[model samples]
Target: MCERNHPMKCFLATLLVAICGLFLHPATAAEDPAALLRAADRWRVSDDSLQVETRVQVLGRDGAVEKERLYTVFVQSGHRSLVLMRSPAEAGQRVLMLGDDFWLLMPGSQRPLRITPLQKLLGDASTGDIATLSWAEDYAGTLVGEESCEGQPCWHLQLRATRAGVSYQRIELWLGKARREPLRAELYVQSDKLAKQARFVLDRPEAPTTVAEMVLRDELGTHKETRVRYLSRTPKRVPEAWMNPMFLARNPPLE
Candidate 1:
């Protein structure tokens, strides 16, 4: 920095430097990607273990409601989750996820069918979408940048799957600038093909504490829309046995 002898010139230079400093963020204050993800995860999960009642509505290309289903998702610790089909048409069907492995059990069958994370549960939503809610646990990446999103400043992050169990191989997540609440995401499969575009709706738009719903649009041929609404969330931990595929199959339903 060069200094000028003139008092007026010196004052102007100092003022200009101060103005630039306001826009400049220090390296030490850089946001941690993991922490940002964890903060954003809270609006969705709300707890480490929770029982979330979910309603999934699949709409056709014309915006006509085609199929609606309900689910009871028991999110547990250690990357274990059990999702039960609550709709009468899909009753007694259960999907269990334990880390990278997944199994599906039919109402009448005692065997648990092995499944993949990318398998669609309904419309554009995959099984992992309902079961795995924490992006910090599944993906890792750096902060991409900041931009205007949904009429508000947003931080954009590009994340990649840390393990093979997650549904999307890569994700472009946008979060609110202030609270770090997730705004939207672009999900990509292992082949790097864009699978779906998702937008989150908050319960309270102005001051949101929880996510009310997620709207997913298919990028595939169907181009249908799927709305996953969180009907209710209760902080409850299921028994350790619920994580077992054989136990889930034999039990059929949990009381």
Candidate 2:
């Protein structure tokens, strides 16, 4: 063994330790993070075209209900999505996401205002949070190694947005090791500042099928909590006209 006073040996050992910390560990380095992420995506969404009923609620400091809103989200293939405000307070309000662009149409507005994905923030959740279901489509990342999350083992992954405009620029996500279920995520904005932290709740703990709710804690301003619950999901496809921004401006009955 090298003596404690051996400067050369000690310096080499210190450099090795530092290098290891900067790179992926050998044990997890071989695993494909993209494949793992795709597996995790299955637990979040399914089917190319799907209709999801979602409810967003924000809680006050005293745990009292502050605001509640319901939205019907229709997600389709080719990076297309439409979210209709289902609640009475926001009835007739619709948001459309066509590729990297987003449009918002209020109850009586004729012209659909052009908006970016980051500009459409609903409470603590962004429009993309409600519309886009698959992260593998927009994000490319590497496995960041395993860590304990809420008394369970989780695979940690660091993801960065690949598109021009999106909700979060980077995300530190955690998924259940066994089932690859999305457990938690730390969302960052374009500036790389932590915007919010989210925890996923499953419908069934044992043999879970899908994520039932997402509980978000605000880190930017209010520091309050917002709960995004998935009320239901069904297989449905909308007409081609529905994808058109002008058609949405006409406000035809979408049912």
**Residue-wise C-alpha lDDT for candidate 1, range 94-204, written one tens digit per residue:** 999999999999987989999998788888878999999999998996787778898999888899899999999999999998899999999998899999999999999
Error of 1 at 131 (Å): 0.6
**Residue 80, candidate 2: C-alpha displacement in angstroms:** 0.6
lDDT value for model 1? 0.89
Per-structure clash totals for the candidates? 0, 0
Give the top-scoring candidate (TM-score).
1
Q: Which pairs clash in the backbone of model 2?
A: none
What's each prediction's TM-score? 0.89, 0.87
| Model 2 clash tally, residue pairs | 0
The segments of candidate 2 whose C-alpha lies over 4 angstroms from its true place after superposition are 1-30
The superposed Cα distance between candidate 2 and the true structure at residue 209, in angstroms, equals 0.7
Predicted structure 2: lDDT: 0.86
